[model samples]
Target chain A: MSTLIDILLLSLMGITALAAVRMKSLFGAVMLTGIFSLLSALWFLILDAVDVSFTEAAVGAGISTVLMLGTLSLTKSEEKTSNHSQIIPLFVVFVTGGVLIYGTLDMPDFADPLAPIHTHVAPHYIEKSGAEIGVPNIVTSVLASYRGFDTLGEVTVIFTAGVGVLLLLGIGRRREDGDE
Target chain B: MTHHFILRVITKLLIPLILLFALYVQFHGDFGPGGGFQAGVIIAAALVLYALVFGLNTASAVIKEWVLLVLIPLGVLIYAGVGVASLLLGGNYLDYNVLAHDPVHGQHLGILLVELGVGMTVAAVLTTIFFAFAGRGHRDANGNLLPHSALSDEIRNRKDGQP
Candidate 1:
């Protein structure tokens, strides 16, 4: 059942990607990308990574869609036709994709108990997180407690991104202008 | 926008619920499929929807840019403050075991506080970015989009010209 769902979702995702790539309108491409994010989010849920899926849906599907639309509004909505050849880029992409797929062949089966991830700290986190952190969600325990520093860095990155955008593009002076 | 009456009405109704859900996700992260990051984005999304419906000016009035600027760093401060606090208590940096007599209880408290900090920062940062992007080139009273100024034309040309 899960495999069937996975196949369906993957097929839909491929279709969305192709459609997005072929799309001429930035608006259409952005919308397709949002659809792609939502589909991947659902796939993550099926894999039981609810936290990752939720973050993907919110950030990728929701916030990014808005941001991309804002970007589109600022620029031309249609792609400018380029006479440049795409052969080299396409060949490079194909080669990279082949290499990645070849590399993944050595990975252990899905949810393999003997996998390095399962044998190492994951079990310890699962076993001791309840008593140590007392959080019902083990992901939360690991994120906010065991891996708290990483999260701090992530927050700092977000802060830095906001500051960068503000520096590059100052906030709108529209409100004050209206009052005058 | 004014003509999109149904959209305006539906957005007005959904904004409160979206905000309430964000709060739920924020506090319930420890027990649910969400956390500070998701909740923060959700909250910003609510504001974004409002801006789309009522106009950017109305949304900016609702949340002053200065307020967002303060909020951005304040969240990181809260998160790091907790770490510093734990350090002051002599349990290493971010070692919440020293927060209370019961180590588990202390961890919970620490997690809640850090998550709050993360939520605040994420929400503020995202909203600020949106304001920056949307407000940089704004609309006139007729609701037509306008570039910031003659200077913005040069900026946009450079931006779009780049690969």
Candidate 2:
């Protein structure tokens, strides 16, 4: 049953991706992209990467959709494809996909406790994080304390994006000017 | 548009619960899956819902643009301030262990402050972005910009009689 479900989910994801990329209407493409993100999030959840799934759902399905829609609002909704061919993009996609698939072949079986990641620093952190940080969530402990600098960098990136948006929109303008 | 009976009743019931859930998520991060970021988004989404029902202008009146502007920087400052405090307390930057006499207590205090900052900045910025997008003119049912007056008078006249 689980295998069947997984196969169905994978097929759906493939269809969504194709639809998202191939749609001629930019608005439809953008919305399909959001659906693709949402389906990917569901896949991540099924794969038991709950934290990653949450991030994907929020950032990919939510924020990226909003950002794309905002961009669409500023531009034409219809995509005009002319005599220009997509040969280069197709080649690039094929090569990238092949490389990724080849790389995955060497990976440990899914959810294997004997996986290198589980045996290495992960066990140490899992065993020691409660004592060291007193936090129940090992992910949060690692994010906020052990690799604190990386999380700080992520926060800075978010802050920078906020600043970029404000700068592009202009900050001091009154709403009466219709620029707010 | 005037308030519908269902919307008015639903908003009154749901808004408070949403606000409460946001606060709970914000404070419960230490124990659960949610954190400042999720809480902030939830809160902002609630406001967005309110705006969708009550109109953007009303929501803006409640939140105010200036307040949001101040909030964005204030959140950044609050977050950075914790790091500075740690530095002053004889630790490296953002070493939350130094925030209090007891290292564990200090860590707790620092996390709280930082989370508060994160929540503030996220909520403010998300709402601001929504406001900017929602206020824009788009083609209406008749395929003309909703506020036709914003266009030139000649252009408006040309398009008016046709559709």
Candidate 3:
């Protein structure tokens, strides 16, 4: 039953992706991308990665949609057709996709017990986090305590991204002032 | 939006609920699926929604630009401060085990404080970005160029049923 739902959701995601790519209106494409993010979030939920699902829903669906809409207001709603040929781009995409698929061939089967990730420090986290951290959520314990430095780095990265956006958009400068 | 009675009423009712939910997700993250990142986005979304309908000036009145600017770095400092505190207490950087007499209690305290810092930084940063995007090329109530105006012509066009 779950597999069927996964298949359905995956197909829907593919359809949404194609629609977003083919859509002429940037607004519609943006909305389709939001739908795509929502479907991906659902897929994450199905995989029992609830934390990932929450981030996907909030960042991808919520924040990105609003930001894209803001961008659209500053630019044209309809994408302008370019005289440039698509053949080279299409060829490049196919090559990249093929290489990515080839790379994945060496990856372990999904959820394999012998996978490196499962064998790695995960066992210790699974067995010891509860007693050591006194937290029911192992994911939080691993993120905040076991790998706290990494979490700090991630937060710093987010802060940097925000600062970068503000810089590019001219946070303190008014548009009317024409100050670069 | 100011002219829309129904929207104004609905927004007034919904903003508090959204903010409350964000806080719930932030503090309850230890036992649940959400964390600082999710809570921050949700809280930023609530503020953005309010700004969208109530105008940027109103939102700014609620949360000033200086406050956001200060908060962005303050959160990171809080997170780093905890690590420094642990280090001074004879633990490695970010090692929460030595934060208190009992390692478990220290871990809990450290996690809670760190998450709060993350939440504060994320919320402030996102809100600042949204303000930067939405406030460009708009005027304030005083007819001055509002540094963080929430006016978007596309939004107005959509609201008016135009393409």
Report the lDDT tens digits of candidate 3 across residue range A37-153: 999999999998998898888888988899899989988899988899999999999999999999999999976889998998889999998899998888888888898999999
Show model 3 residue runs off by greater than 4 Å: A172-176, B139-163
Give the poorly placed runs of model 1, Cα more than 4 Å off.
A172-180, B139-163
Residues B1-163, candidate 1, lDDT per residue (tens digit)?
Answer: 5699999999989999999999999999999877888899999999988987887778887998789989999999999999999999999898999998889889989999999999999999999898878876454433334543744775576578767
Better of 2 and 3 by TM-score: 3
Instruction: Give the better candidate number (1 or 3) by lDDT.
Output: 1
State model 2's lDDT: 0.74
Which candidate wins on DockQ?
Answer: 3
Residue pairs with backbone atoms closer than 3 Å in model 3 (clashes): B135-B149
Q: Comparing candidate 1 with candidate 3, which one achieves the higher DockQ?
A: 3
Error of 3 at A17 (Å): 1.1
Instruction: Using TM-score, rank the candidates from best to worst.
Output: 3, 1, 2
Best by TM-score: 3
| TM-scores for every predicted model | 0.89, 0.82, 0.90
- C-alpha DockQ for predicted model 1: 0.46
Q: Which CAPRI category fits model 3?
A: acceptable
Model 3: residue A154 alpha-carbon error in angstroms: 1.4
